[model samples]
Target: AKIIHEELATALGPNTPSYQTVARWAKRFREGSEDVNDDFRSGRPVSVLTDENIELVRQVINNDPYSIYDDIIAETSLCRGTIEQIIHNYLKMKKVTSRWIPRQLNDEQKQERVRLCRENLAKFRDGFWRLCNIITDDETWIYHRQIHHKSTNKTWIGEGASPRTIVRRSKFEPKNLFSMFFKSNGPVLIHAVDNNETIDHDYYIENCLKPVVKEIWKQRKSNGTKDIKLLHDNSSPHRHPHVINYLTEEGINIMPHPPYSPDLAPCDYWLNDYIKQNLTDQPDKKSLARAISKLIKNIPEEEFKKTFDKLLERLELCINNHGDYFEHLIK
Candidate 1:
């Protein structure tokens, strides 16, 4: 019986029956029984869901929202599948990780967010800024080595087969900082920050703003640069007086961006993460800047237009949510 079980296990993998089950079947077959199924005798199957069990599961989950299937199983005599069914079907709840926000807001900051969202929403409502006339930019770091997401390691296998393993790269891995600026039409400028340089007021003027302004002049020949609305975060360099003056002299309309609000920024809520996702497991590169630039240039203009449309929806949602973080609620 043991030898047969081992052989069945090797060939059938997880489908192989237990040794006791095999022995019993072998005995039955010797007595001329050829049927594989159990003899009919039905009431409720072995595992059952009772009302008392449901209430118990509810109490356990209510006490601790973070409770897992195993945690509930340890507290009750119910099986894993029963507990899962109770939580999902009965209680209408599922386990989920918390969504990350850029930062927690104080009361004043939240009200400020509401005010700015209202202001921006009014601009779109009154036809002051078309999606194509808005320019936005942000900075993010690109790690030399891409992370192997644990979720992506999942694959189809036999029930008893072990899952594939993954080890994420270290948090302090070597990386490069890259800045990207784009409009609804497409990319205007993208470049890697020099390792030795700081992104100060002077650097912002010469490297980032100047090239973008020149592009604006070329792209907006019909309306001139005055019709363009610039949207960026309230970083120290971005808020510099000299930078403001330069933009004012260039006749660029500065859009008010709330502090600590990545949820509202196009690059933060979409572009940067999209770029990082597409960067994974591809051919190795000597320069991340070149790779990101190529990717941006190759993307269809419709995608950029779609993101800008979502920006309008997000602004309205921010107002409706009373400036709460609603990026998670957005698709």
Candidate 2:
């Protein structure tokens, strides 16, 4: 304490640090700290956070981002605190939950995506009526437990006390498949497929596709419009001979959708995100469907318009990227 105080008095005449601050610095230096210079409580120790050590930590992390602090410490001569400070504060990096992509596309799939986007853009060059007329559908598995991001789970808790525990979800949690159909206006229907139901050609036509088409027809009839453009992935169930015949007979304009292109679908990119955000506490299948339905129905028309507008921007981005994934561009 006296040493730090004397140093402070010599440095700043009559504006020396208080006894408490001096005592703290003295204790820090006594605890094997090499530096006699005092820093803010949260500031790094100059002896450890050197430029060389920082570069070493960066190199080790670049080699393996998932490397733990202890591993990095073993690789370099840095202490755990210094490694963590370099990785988090200096590098501005964080561990985040991995998103689930539908499939890894090859070169051919990429070219197809680009071609489809360009063709669709040329087809609907003038206005958004084609987009508005488009009805998209997709099936997704709805789990009882929603994914909680690690970044979002942080809280202002008392020091030394852990955050409150949430109910641990199982890796093999109970889940059900749901087929959702939607237009530019809003959701048309969200159907929960029955348990033990095989989503094959016959099952899809009878249960999901047929019912969704009827609903769209009824809606268009009420609005004094007849033509409806359908958009769905090229799944086997969707491309079955009977399914094609049914759509053709019904006079629904089938929009071309490339396989493994969920990013182009509003249901996957927009509605699913909405449901995950609004219905974060889903406890059962029925409750989840109900919550999703309510949320979908409650979304404002302006929001739907904005979402549809984004399709154009995404399509243009896809074309510009030559059919590569363009999410990073938006971010």
Candidate 3:
């Protein structure tokens, strides 16, 4: 007390309480005569959050590190203050300090996409519909792993649940499936294997594509359409010299689709999603084969017709929207 009083008096003025007088007053106050000491207080005491709640927070962050505090609170039923305290005291987490990243296509790329869409539209609309028809094709691998519906859960099983025995598969099991889509036809043709080798250009041409093309030509002949066009993306097999030469000699027009333009392909963007939905809950080799067959068989003839009709509709929409759809495509 005396030291404090002396320091204060020296810092302030000589008229302040002297050190001895200040000490006498402090002694008097300490003898239960007065409440002179300032209250020893601070901001609200820190909270103690539960370990379980902290673990829950860690789990949520692990699952999705980009989630905000409010999202964590909503998911875990933890209050905002509790979450903040847990993050600050227990987790010692810090907010990321980084510049904002912008996602925007440059002007030149946008212009090129727009131009390509416009050119394709013009070709289809210029009274050469027979010669300029578009057919987008691409291949996708189908694994033979057991599949289940998104809604399936363990609760769906019986109480005395004995695990079902599954035969172990060999490493080289020929269970992979290769499929291709013809935008004009809803028939998703499944390529068959003659040996253990995966399908390449030769296999595709021999087993799958040749038959489909023949069927298309037969239909065209029946409809009295002499000029036929096929549109395919720039995949290695599709762009093979032999394949191109064969199609050229056969007087079939093959339009080359721009690379990295899957978003613009209706078969890739639309029909694939449709097919995947039907494949849910169909697992194992036998059931998968059945599901594929059922999906293909159930595609109404009118659906194929509608797909072709949508191409024209999309082309018109692209032009009317001033290539807005095309801009979205590349993005």
Candidate 4:
């Protein structure tokens, strides 16, 4: 009323009707007794969502964004109207779902990898090409596991149709085999035996290194060649003092293979995979051993010749590619 009186006094000069008269007019205006009146809104007014419901919607979206409105309602015990209202009004989150994909290696990692591979190649230059001059040896376990053929979705059409089940022909204990491949030749030696024990330092020296070295020495003597280099990974047995002393006395070059760098080893990178693929349809240990033994013994003379040739080729590729594949080593 005071504001209205002041406004009237200012607009109509110093003399104007007081606040009491304006107040009476304002009351009449509100009651619809006057020309001007205010009307209050009346209807089913919009409801505001609570903070708790908004948080619940966020949790649901985080867990599984593709969840349908009905699923959310069922899970959260929230009504469809409430979910929609919260999503649109309070949360304001968009439903854009996409599968998460990982990013690939960066440029710097690739270059560093290439560099290390080249360095390893430089160290072993010309040494790999010498005939039966170097033999790389390693051991792997062959478990008595069944090999499954690729399946096809076909049904047998017969009254007495029996669904196919894998057959267990025979059982064999876990076996360990020692394999050796000449750098200049293909796989030249393989030994598979049934020993119900783990290979330890003594077993490695007595069973693996001693026999192989003896054979290599014998071959060198027959060929009237000088001492040969024995290339092997740093398996605990190979690095034992006994094995080291023996190699040192024999005047054999023991090429140092970097730890955890199986990819650089020829036996790992080339021959092992080749052998495994060729010896397919393996069901049990006895058959697997036989197949492997046959494959190793009957490796064509030419395959051995190709071993060093392939190594050289790979080395050149590594040099040319700048060790991009060897980046895993740098890390």
Clashes of each: 0, 0, 0, 7
In model 2, pairs of residues that clash are: none
Model 2 lDDT tens row, 1-331: 7776888888997888787988987787688887766556866645777888889888988998788778898999777877788878988888775655677778999999998888888778955447778888888877777766666667789889978776777868888788888878888778888887869999888888788877876777675235677888888898998988888887776788877887888878887767765666678878888877787789998887788788888889988888877776786
Residue pairs in clash, model 1: none
RMSD of each: 10.0, 9.0, 14.9, 17.3
Model 1 segments beyond 4 Å from truth? 1-59, 69-90, 153-167, 280-286
Q: In order, what lDDT does every prediction score?
A: 0.85, 0.80, 0.63, 0.65
lDDT of 1 by residue, 155-179 (tens): 8989899876556777766777877
Clashing pairs in 4: 113-326, 113-327, 114-322, 114-323, 114-324, 185-304, 186-304
Per-residue error for 123 in candidate 3, Å, reads: 2.1
Residue-level lDDT tens digits of model 4 in 254-290? 7655455455567776677667655655566678777
| Candidate 1 global CA lDDT score | 0.85
The C-alpha TM-scores of every prediction are 0.74, 0.68, 0.53, 0.51
Residue 79 miss distance in model 1 (angstroms): 8.0
Considering summed lDDT, which 10 consecutive residues are worst modelled in model 1? Answer: 280-289
Candidate ranking under lDDT, highest first, comes to: 1, 2, 4, 3
Question: Is candidate 2 or 3 superior in TM-score?
Answer: 2
List candidate 4 stretches off by more than 4 Å: 1-120, 123-132, 145-183, 222-225, 280-287, 316-331
C-alpha lDDT (0 to 100) for residue 202 of candidate 4? 77
